[model samples]
Target: MTVITGPLAKQERDDTGALLQSTLVDLLDLSLLAKQAHWNVYGPRFRAVHLQLDEVVTTARDYADQVAERAAALGVSPDGRAGTVAENSGLPAFVSGWVDDGKVVEAIVQVFSTLITRMRARIDEAGRSDAVTQDLFLSLAAALEKQSWMFQAENRA
Candidate 1:
């Protein structure tokens, strides 16, 4: 039962909602993974990597809100519950306990790599269904790509 309605048609709203929902799950998981790394990162580059992880957390959270709000605007219920994110997110899981700075960077790079690829596909798909959602995906892709590049730089030998 949706109380809100936007300009999108039913099919457009449905497709956009699905795209945003997937993006929401990934973004929520990304924030959690980054926070976990932020708490346990160690080694020579600990300070830098730890701070960078915080940046990722902030980015993911900010975008998650945007995506969720976009869904709500379209009369679609947004689900960011723990179970939903855990089951639906496409992001790679982070190892538990303390992690080396190098490993953290490697893992984050991998996450962003996978997320960016998926975001590109969503962007393309949304382009056909809803340009507004496609624009959001494009913005998200830029930010994720930038973060990925920064992490990749740290991982370089």
Candidate 2:
């Protein structure tokens, strides 16, 4: 952790930064997954799913930026390098090559669900250390939940 003169205590900053960094890694991975789905999805709903996946990718990138910036503010070096994200991200590996619209929706829904769950836990963890960080996680979690709902809606029978 880098030296920080923030209001949070050293340990609090360290702990909170750790949680944010982890979230950043997952968000980065999820963004890539979204793009993979966007590029590969095909079927009756191909146009709709393809466009929606772009939105998901944009949101993931935005969220990742927020998490990384927050971690940096807390004095931690956010590890967002491709290698770091590849190794540390908690998200499942995305399928390569072409995929059907239904399969793409399924994969994206699963990814969003996993990320939402993890973000909720990080919100709690941040609450224990810093309310500011907790609020950040809360906002991220809300967005992820919405994305998850949207993706799930597409997959319903």
Candidate 3:
């Protein structure tokens, strides 16, 4: 990898890289969760929820890419294999292609809730380590929270 010099300190870059690697697992796990739900969700509101799930799945994939790039920027390879995700993801694996919508929603809520907590912790770490990473995580936390609200809204509807 080419050298990077910015306002970021060397130690901060290292820490941000570690944080991004850990977040790589979260993003991938979350991506699968959204995809699984997208493919399997069914109910009275099936069509609408299914479409929303598709949007979530797509966005999750993008988020995964961003985090992986962050890891690569730090000179460490990002883990992309399913096996690595199985071993490293802090969130539960969502593998079934056929599941009840309620169950799917509940499971996804559980996953993103973990994401909120994890992102907050990472934000704290980055706040101390790298302002750039911290800025990114701050925006990420807001987006994830907004996504969580979307999931929460389903129950109210």
lDDT value, residue 37 of candidate 1: 95
Highest TM-score model number: 1
Question: CA shift at 147, candidate 2, in angstroms?
Answer: 0.9
- How would the candidate models be sorted by lDDT, starting from the highest? 1, 2, 3
Residue lDDT tens for model 1, 1-157: 7799889999999999999999999999999999999999999999999999999999999999999999998899999999999999999999999999999999999999999999999999999988989999999999999999999999956
Error of 2 at 49 (Å): 0.6
Best first by TM-score, ranked: 1, 2, 3
- Clashing residue pairs in all predictions, respectively, total 0, 0, 0
Candidates' C-alpha lDDT: 0.95, 0.86, 0.77
Question: Could you give candidate 2's per-residue lDDT for residues 1-157 as a string of tens digits?
Answer: 3465667788998898789889989989988989988888899999989999888889889988988888878777788999998889999788889998999888888788778888888888888998988998888888888888888889955
Which 10 consecutive positions of candidate 1 have the poorest summed lDDT?
148-157
Clashes of 3: 0
lDDT score for candidate 3 against the true structure: 0.77
- lDDT tens per residue, model 3, 111-152: 889989999999999888777667777877887888778878
Worst 10 residues of 2 by lDDT: 1-10
Residue 27, candidate 3: how far off, in angstroms?
A: 0.4
Over 4 Å off, model 1: none
